[model samples]
Target: MFMSRLRRRMGRLAAGVLALAALEGTCTALAQQMPAMPVTVANPVSRKITESIEFTGRFQAWPQVNITSRVTGYLDKSSFVEGSLVKEGDVLFSIDPRPFQAAVDQAAAQVKITQTRIDLTKANLARAEALKKTGNVTDATYQANLQAYQEAAASIDSASAALATAKLDLNYATITAPISGRITRQLVSRGNLVVANSTSPLVSIVAVDPIYFYFDLDEASYLAYQRASKRKMDAGDAEPALKAEIGLSDEKALSHQGTLDYLAPQVDAQTGTVTARAKVANADGFLTSGLFGRIRITIGEPYEALVVPDVAVGQSSQGRYVIVVGADKIANIRPVELGPKFGSFRVIKSGLKPEDQVLINGQMRARPGGEVVPQPTKLDVPETLVPDPN
Candidate 1:
């Protein structure tokens, strides 16, 4: 009877242990099947947006002048400070005046001497005329006196002209600024001999207060711009009325605004591009010549476009893409076409629908063909891409 009881107890314990093990196995299986990862998603914001194009360009001074001496002489002194603002008619440099003054004096003395000679000849001619009336002078003597008088008159005129020329030379000895602008350092210092009409410049001046920005537009873009403006190359308007903006190398926003004032008459065959120019105001003298900048111009009319934050876009070996969640709560990869950036938002050309939910956050945890718990949200879109003045 004891052996039978022990056997029954062992069997009951074995069955109970098997049942416990099965219960634990079922719990482990349930734990392995986890819920979907949560992610933040939002529908793309649709709005009327004007497309803009950007190109690398440089700042240029429209009226740059190279200062040079008009008369050959030793440079006496420079009147203006280097790198200083100068106005029209301001004395820039002065050549030695001693030689010019001496020339003027000599010309004036020559004029006086010619006048004295003319006076003496006039007296002699009067005497000859009186002698001729009295039959005391021959015809040849009278003719000779008249000729002398005429020669003296001619000599006086020549001397007077020489005096005027000398005065002009003296005036040119003092060099003056031709235009109002910022002047560069003096290349020819004081006491240096400078030749007239030389290619070497004494200094250079550039107008900064209405600077110019120059860039090149590809042939295709040139055609598109012409069509958008409704103006052809043969049109009477040389400058299109398009507006342009510029951003410096270290800048993000194109804060400098200007008008498209110049365009090349023909496309360059070698470069396949057309040169374009803009005029921008530089009241503070911030824009400088030869500085590399980025120029932006609106290409076409405003159209409706879907946009999302730039962070939402992802890059892959193929190209740019975005993760979108569908109705079934599954993440899918959608290839995207990108346009210019508007502040922090990026324009999506295609491959995205207005109603599709794009993953903006927790992108790392999301994968294509994976289940996700999407948290719906909205994007803050700006009315205009322009930065606030404040």
Candidate 2:
């Protein structure tokens, strides 16, 4: 019985020793991980910010006109050399005038013949009137002669008008440009017959000094702007009108500046977008018609915001989150409210404090309440920046 009691006492002593050793190992491991990690962080400071929207579109001239011939004949001459500057009233083409000239001459000869007939009738009426006075001619004969003379005079007037119309037709054979512009390639060459109402246009003229750009914005953008403006009014904040800038993606800012000319009244039902146009001056003709371009629009100013590097942020079934090392060196995951992404940084709307030593490095493999040894590193700088206010 005494030997049995001795064995029991030894067993209890051995169990106690093993438990104490485990406690010591855990304490030592935790002590090795505690240190202030060397990290570069940015403050959630106040400054002016802008919400920008970008889109692609094509450039086109404001006014483009097509030049066509009104009257048709053989194109005898192309007054405008193909691809040359022409002014208003500049003679552009000439048709063969022989045919129209012959027409004018024939009408003139007819008018002369009518004049001779009228002169003869007037003399005959005078002779008839003298005979009537002597009673040698009947009153009926005298009345007939006077009527014939009046009729002949009417014929001469009608013939003279016909001759004038023929001359006008001859003038039309020579064509002139209606407007001052750069002429396009001649559609008809010399010796090509042109009908008075031909289906084809002789050439085209486009005014290229001022150009327009067409772009589109979605409904979400429109709604966002409206909400932003309403918020300012409710809070009695200074509401500023929005502005925009434009550039070719490959090129720098356009030298000439202009304004947003129009916004469509209703959304485009087919695409669920609102069409907008910007007018850009091109007096130098640098911006050609039908060229591609992009517009960077500044919609609103930035509000106060807190942000963190995108690399440090993590996502799960619970949405975006980050591991925050508490003051006691305990790691805890906190849910964060995130706003728009600005380059490599994410705007933290809420749920994170500025003083938090956010474990940016090794976040992909870390967990909450687990032992964390921080290895500090450089923060990423955003390449594209929002508009900064002075």
Candidate 3:
């Protein structure tokens, strides 16, 4: 009975070991047959992009004027309200005209007195000429009469000049705006004495519309712009107008467009930079002088380039990179050199080919060497890109 029990126990132990081996083999097969993680991929989109450089800049009023008194007098009244927009030629301030008008009247009376003196001198000279011709007058007497007539004529000319000057002084008493712009507060109050040719300004005005923008470009950027301009002219095209885009500090992108109208005659030796200026229309008067902003200027012509959406580009310890799926359906991280942004897409300066498949979605499931099932799709690019106000 003891020998039979031992034989049954041995048989049961062998069967249990064989069942465990079959179960392990079945799990290995199931793992091998599993499908790859699905991911969305697209080829780099071809687009026309231009190379550009950006700089920090500020907005300035195109023409700013300081209002001052041309003639000395007491301030009579002001025609404009403080902090108001004034039209060109609108009256701004009025100096006391009573004093200037009185001076003009005095000058006019002096001119009349000189005219009366000239008549008397003419009559005496004529009588002297007749008496001399008849030998009734002495030669010395006739000579004196002639000299008197000449002196009277000269006196009248002097008096006439004084009258003209007085009239000009009278007109200057009424000050007018030299330009259309917003004016500052009056520095001198009514009934206060104001002096002529004073360094102090009574008020200030700044033209806000069609504002000017000033920026400095590095030496390298200046040279590149010159080269690109020359190439454009050589191609029988108009010299490429150096255009600029501007953005305020709060803005995300440059949107306001302007033309680079003026460049400094020479570069600054100390700064090693060239000064550039641009003009932008500000009819709404939103942009103001002394406001700091960013500016961007294109230095190259448009050319075909490979681009990918900004979100697809990733940052890592190595640098900027993108995940590219190869022919073997394996995801590989590619390090790429990046260029300026072109709308929502980023310009890939290098390390990307137009034919390479880039994974755009399901990045979390992707590993550097992991296999993936890529879903091919077309990249939709906008027909027109809105101007970026730098």
Candidate 4:
């Protein structure tokens, strides 16, 4: 009975070991035949990318003018509608002209009186000369008549100068726009007494077309731009005009194109930055002065760069990375150094090549070192995706 029990136990142990071995073999075969994770893949795009820098700026009118009273008088009427556009030399306000006109009349009367005196003095001098030649008047008396004639002529000249001054004052009664621009609200209303050349202005005007955009460049950016400019000059190439783009605060993309026109010669001591300006066309009068804007300027020449869809980038403790397919159809994790965004694509500054195939979709299923079934596809880079040229 002891021998029979021992045989049964040995048999059972042997059967269990065989079963375990068979199950292990089946599992290995099944894993080997398993299908790879399906994923969409594309090669990195190669393009000439121009590096750029963005800054906050404000739009300013090309010409700003303050309309002030030239002569003291009561404001009679305003020729322009408040907040309306005005052309150069357009009349804006009218001061009370009666006072200026009365002054002019007084000056004219003085001129007339001086002319009559001159005529009388000339007649007397002529008579004195005739009398003197005929020995009727003394030599001293003739000399006195000549001196009186000269004094009358000098008085006429003074009266004429006074008349001119009066006429100028009359012209000053009409305040006109010095430039073509949009006028601000009337600062001094009609019927208000305005002082001549006062600290307060009657109105303000700002040029609308061809607006100016002003921005500041930090010390580092200014130095970089200077170095780039020097390099271009040293290469015997004509320095290309720097181009810029502008967008209003509410805008998504930079829709306005402009050219960099001015750069301050010295950095601001208080701000540690250099002021720069660009000219932008605003024929439609869409842009207004004092409006905030976002500006981008191309800082360097175009060079070849690698780009990929922004969706392919992943963030982790190791930083940004993308899934790439290897030659053996295995998924590999690649860390990338990212740069500025180009539309829906991200610029890969490093750790990527133009020829490498990257997984665009199904990245979650494609584990590192795992096999993948890549669906080859082409990347569509639209013309709008390209940034504005420098």
Candidate 5:
């Protein structure tokens, strides 16, 4: 009887243990099936994006001038401070005016002397004519007096020319600025002898406002610009004004706006590149001459393009790519060709469609071929991010 009771108890204990094991296995399977990873996704933004090309260039001032003396004399004094701004017609240097002033005064005295002689000659000639009419003077004497009067008049004319020349030389004694600009150091200081029309400059000046930006475009870019210009002309429309943006080497954002003003007529044979120039305003005088700058030119017309937030883009051995969430809630990597960046969004030249949903936030949680619980969200885009049509 005791043996049979012990065997029954063992059988019941085994059945209970088996039931508990089955329940635990079922609970584990259900937990594994539950979704754990959460990710934020959004549809790719569709907009008309302008494509631009970048080039390295330098800033140059317009109307750069080398200031030199027009007349030879000892340097007297300068009206301008070194490296200071000067206005047009402002006297820059005053040469030794004593010599020029003396010449002018001497010429003036000669003119007065000549005028007195002319008066005396007139009086004498009148007397001679009167005597000749009364038959009191011989014909030879009258003719000789007339000849003397003509000679005196000729001398007065010569003195007048000398006076005019002297005044011009006096005016040249004071050197004035031809154009408004920032002047360099005085090459010839006070008390130093300077020669007229010398090759060496006394100072140099460069115009700050409305500066020029020069850059080189390869043959391919030159041809592209020409084609676009030609197309506009053929359509009976005015040539579109090309625009450029510039930033200094130390700057990260392009803040300067400029207009394309010049294009080389021919390409350089040696470099196979053409020179291009843009005019930029420098009202505040922030841009200095010979500054290294980065420039971007809008070379293409606006077109529909897919753009994703810069955070959405990733990189690997396969280059740049983005994660897109499909209808099955699975993350897939889409390789893309990138163009210029527009604000916080990067222009995807390819590998993305307008309706495609891309993973924006929680990128780490999302992996290729992996399931995700996608939460739809909106992207923050700037209103003025698009390029101006004009």
Candidate 6:
């Protein structure tokens, strides 16, 4: 009797537990089908956004000059130090001037001799003219004396010009910098003989105050920008005007500054691209010549732009689209015309409006035209952006 009672009590307790568990599962299932899945979105409006054309170019000095020696002689001394800034007319090197100095002296002596001869010839011509009047000399003799004096005067002038030429040649032996700039090291050392008008250069000078950055644009990009501009102008946007800025690859931007200084008149037939140039200041000497530089050119004005996260945009054979949330909590797959991409955002040129909210999270599993419960989530994190390495 006791064993039967214990077994019957245990069986009753187990049956009650099973019934409660089944009721709880049924209630949980009903709750899950009640609340809707959530998503996030953002607002769009008019912003001063920039569109940039990317190109890989290099930095070059504005003025580069190769210093060459104009006189033939052994270099006696280098006046200016290597890699030093020099002014125009600053003596860069001194050549052995003993030979040139002797040559100048010889030219001067020749001029003096020619002048003495001219004086003597003039005296003889005067005496001959007097004798001709007195009938003591023939006309031919007087004429010959006159010619001799004129020839002597001509010889003096020629000698003076020769002296000046010799002095100039002597000055050339001391090679001075032609431009005010930073000059490279002496190509030939002291006691090394450099010839005049030779192939070798004695040094080089480069101006570094304001540097130039050059880049290229292919024909396709050029034409595409033109076509897009025409369409924009037709659609009531202003005429096609482009601007630009500069940035280091490792930095956001050196500054929000730069200008479109140059554009090629004709396209390069070989590469089918147009060359462009930008001038940037380097006052602190931070920028070095021949360093790699980036040139960014923005082509057009900022519009009343609609933007969405790049991840939210899905592409297909039809076109790019996004699962957009419209009025009455309805979800719709809307096709959009996309403009240039700026960072992580895509500019929507058409289709979606400013009020349209785009679904970012839980978008892949969401069904179109279904009820969307927008759950605004904060995505600000400590490591959202990873900066590029230097």
Q: Which of candidates 4 and 6 reaches a greater lDDT?
A: 4
Please estimate how well model 1 matches the true structure, expressed as its whole-model Cα lDDT: 0.89
* lDDT of prediction 5: 0.86
TM-score between candidate 3 and the true structure: 0.79
lDDT of 4 by residue, 1-390 (tens): 999999999999999999999999999888677789799999998767878888898999978888898899999999988888889999889999999999999999999999998999899999999999889999999999999899999999999999999999999999889999899998877899999999899899999988999999999878877777777778786854577889999888888999877889999999999999989999878899999998888877777778899999999998999999988999999999987787788888899888889999998778788899999999986543555322
Runs of candidate 2 exceeding 4 Å displacement: 1-28, 31-33, 81-91, 96-182, 222-244, 252-258, 262-270, 300-390
- Tens-place lDDT per residue, model 2, 84-147, is 6666788888888888899899999999998898999899999998998899999999999999
**Angstrom error at residue 281, model 4:** 2.5
Error of 4 at 82 (Å): 1.2
RMSD of 2: 8.8
Give one digit per residue, the lDDT tens place, for model 5 in 51-146.
Answer: 677788999998999988878999999999898888899999999999999999999999998889889888988999999999999999888889
In candidate 5, stretches whose alpha carbon ends up further than 4 angstroms from where it belongs are 1-40, 123-149, 228-241, 310-339, 348-353, 358-375, 386-390
Pairs in clash, predicted candidate 5: none
Give the best candidate by TM-score. 3
TM-score of 6: 0.76
- For candidate 1, write residues 116-172 as lDDT tens digits: 999999999999999999999999999999999999999999999999998888898
Q: For each candidate, what is the lDDT? A: 0.89, 0.72, 0.88, 0.88, 0.86, 0.75
**Which 10-residue span in candidate 4 carries the lowest summed lDDT?**
381-390
User: 112, model 2: CA deviation in Å?
Assistant: 9.7
Mark the 10 consecutive residues where model 1 has the least summed lDDT.
381-390
Q: After superposition, how far is residue 290 of candidate 3 from its true place, in Å?
A: 1.7
Error of 5 at 108 (Å): 1.0
For residues 280-309, could you state the per-residue lDDT of candidate 3 as single tens digits? 888878888999998888888887778888
Tell how far residue 118 is off in model 1, in angstroms. 3.5
lDDT head-to-head 5 vs 6, winner: 5
Clash pairs, candidate 1, are none
